[model samples]
Target: MNTYLQVAAADASEHRTLIITLFSVFVAATLGVTVWAGRRTKDATDYYAGGRSFSGFQNGLAISGDYMSAASFLGIAGAISLFGYDGFLYSIGFLVAWLVALLLVAEPLRNSGRFTMGDVLAYRMRQRPVRTAAGVSTIVVSIFYLLAQMVGAGALVALLLGVSGDAGKNVIVVLVGVVMILYVTIGGMKGTTWVQMIKACLLIAGTLLITFLVMLKFDFNISTLLGAAAENSGQGAAFLEPGLKYGVSTTTEIDFISLGLALVLGTAGLPHILIRFYTVPTARAARKSVIWAIGIIGAFYLMTIALGFGAAALLSRKEITESDAAGNTAAPLLAQNIGGGADSAGGAILLAVICAVAFATILAVVAGLTLASSSSFAHDLYANVIRKGKASDREEVKAARVSSILIGGVAIVLGIFAGKLNVAFLVALAFAVAASANLPTILYSLFWKRFNTTGSLWSIYGGLSSSVLLVVFSPVVSGNPSAMFPGADFQWFPLNNPGLVSIPLGFLLGWLGTVVSKNEDVDGRKYAELEVRSLTGTGAH
Candidate 1:
């Protein structure tokens, strides 16, 4: 018995070798791709939008890779594993948000802009101010999203390697931040796109394999799987119902509505997603890309159902919670269980492989986010706003590289501070900020002729400030055990998300700022031209 137990313990402790080996292999492969892509990045066009050379299908896969972030893979799976029906609601909201993007944002955005959202917003307004607002907002929103990715990286690596201290996780977070900076600085858009596409494929394959094993175990019956999950959840029938996570209180119900609004509207405004539209050569390709992304992303979320419930059914709640109290490790744990349990070689190999795929997902995602923000800073703030559009291509690209390092540094610092938060919930806060600030300004610029620079400034600044301020004073920051600082009780805002109040206020401020300002004759002419270009792709880069 002692000899047998010794072998098992040896295997358990040494599994991290497999994880490190897999992670290093992926990192080396992606870095090779980055060096290759870096050679082709010759100018602003190449660096910013991959020279508009990507096909609809290629960009589609890249879009799916960028969209299905750690929040989707790790956080949503964890949420569903713990909360059942209410957790699945996140999947529905995320999928539906693509329709909003397709119908309202994608084609027009592709036609109207060159690199950043500022290219479109500054098209009709005063170039400097609008671009400045856009640059600031892009950095803020991308940082919020970046925090979630970093946190996931730290958690996944530390948990799989059995590192028990915050110091190890903190070190991993710094390493991830450094890697993301290298990707953006070295490869630009072409390298980032290829990394995303590869990661997307690996993530999908891993999820599918685990999902298939899960379905086979349950005899391919979803209802049977769900029933078992509920029974195992200890909440019985309540586990399969809507009130398990939300709707328990009136405040909770309203919070759900707020979250729904944010998720539904947020994708259209996200800086990284908006930038994806520019990767394709034309508006038609952009639309095609969105269609492909929706199908792939939709299928992925559907399989999340299997992964989540499968974890709930196969593992005890105590087991899931004990692995990572926030359930962040649920997916890997499920992979381990489905691969013949932890004592077996299959379990260790499967765990390491899935986590490596997840690590790939994190690296690709952070690269995209960093690229978006750095591009905004270089193109909008440094080149256009500060230099008055006279900065040369070499100078602009240099600025973007410098800014990527700085932004990555800031993300590393903030991520360590918010390391304990749920990745999905952190992403929701990002969505709320994007929807409240960027979406209102984008719609006004595209559809409303009377919209002026005053309106744009009011919308972006008002929306950004209000949403951020509310979150700072909300329960998410204090007065709750799960808050960033639970020891303090300074929360004054009631909602967990600020979308309910901030989104409407953004629209109202834009309208109010517009009707009160003098409508310029030059503005009307610019709007007419912008309308033609936005609709018909005339003068598109």
Candidate 2:
């Protein structure tokens, strides 16, 4: 049979039909809830911040939904399928990052600001340059991250739905974008939170089901699974070990370090994640949300290991191998191979659920990202800077809605252009940028009293510039330099990830900027009061 014909025939099976039906139901319910919640939003603050009414638990679940992208769902699974134990490094690194968010950043961030991370940083300092810099960084990071998710969503839907060519992906972009915009514009934070929470539960349950079933296939004996996997691949238990390669070079070490830095530090900097902190009413609630988020996220990552390994063990090597040698399609393909072909009722249902969840994940993140971007542009840029704080809350909210439409459109266009790029790789790039640009300044502002606004600006600029430049030179960026200057394909950086280099530079620049501006500081007492209030909530606006 022709390969394309086989794929087309497999997709037309009864199992694929079941999967499609199940997925439609799940997504429809999610959209309904989001639209219902949207009706309560009346003003800008209500829309962007969900009226500051959510408790920590709700916010935390939503945060988990936001954090677990298609990369986590599909990319991690694919990585494990291809690299054995080495792929697990991604899960471990991602889980540990929450420790930073829970222990160091959460409470302080929630207590200090309103809409964007910039709001917190600029609360006590001179607003002009700092706010503008933060606004720019948030949009840039959000755009990069959004692109990866959108691309992943499109591909996942296409693969699961059996849609030929780009049609499925394009449909997904419209579906997800429209649903998410309704979630934000109509229900605001309240609606988005509920949708996210539900989606999180569904995602966790689905992953757990896949993991449990995979283990059951081996009589619940992990050792049996591991042995089979090793024998099949001839890599032994080392397939379950850290590092993708046995003998790592200096360059490889640097790359690993860079990847780790992004995973560890980027959690706090993500715009969607940061905006989540503002949903809960109190600083303590924000702290509690992080604690809950860590537990949920940790549990999900643990399951990813099972799914990835299961894919490697169950699927035929020929069928499981990715076109790019990356193992991206292993999970879904393995499911079809084992649970019954795409024609099997069970397989189709599973496929549909996975596809819907993928769609939901992208939508939730984009809504949050759009909210963050719009809030920064509308509240930080237009309201704070352009209007000199004269704009009413109503005007700010309207501007945010408009921004959402614009950003969502751009995301749709980018998603189409992104085509077949492995989403896991793109997500890593976003993480690198977030860690380099956003984390250092946030940490310094909350912990270092001597930190001045000028230092914050320097850190943001330096970090943003370095990360973007490094990514531009990486293989992924070099592969398509249509967006860059002619003949700039030369890569200055050896590693694909720039977190290790750029994150430190941000911290250093922030420190230096603080020292230089410390002498000319105005309003030390006022600054101290703001810090005190942020921690204790006595002087909160």
Please write out the lDDT profile of model 1 over residues 1-541, one tens digit for every residue. Answer: 2432244335558786777788899999999999999999999899999999999999999999999999999989888999998888889988999998999999998999899999999998889999999999999999999999988998888767766567988999999999999999999999999999999999999999999999999999999999999999998999898988787899989999999999999999999999999999888999999999999999999999998899999988877766566677789889988998878889889988999999999999999999999999999999999999999999999999999999999999998877777788889999999999999999999999899999999999999999999999999889987787888999999998999999999899989988888775444898898889888888868
> What's the lDDT of the predicted structure labeled candidate 1?
0.91
Scored by CA lDDT, what does every candidate get?
Answer: 0.91, 0.76
Candidate 1: where are CA atoms >4 Å away? 1-12, 521-523
Measured by TM-score, the strongest candidate is 1
* Deviation from truth (RMSD, Å), model 2: 2.9
For residues 403-438, could you state the per-residue lDDT of candidate 2 as single tens digits?
A: 878887887787776656666667788888888889
The C-alpha RMSD in Å for every predicted model, in order, reads 2.3, 2.9
Candidate 2 Cα errors over 4 Å, as ranges? 1-9, 13-20, 164-175, 234-238, 245-248, 322-326, 479-488, 518-523
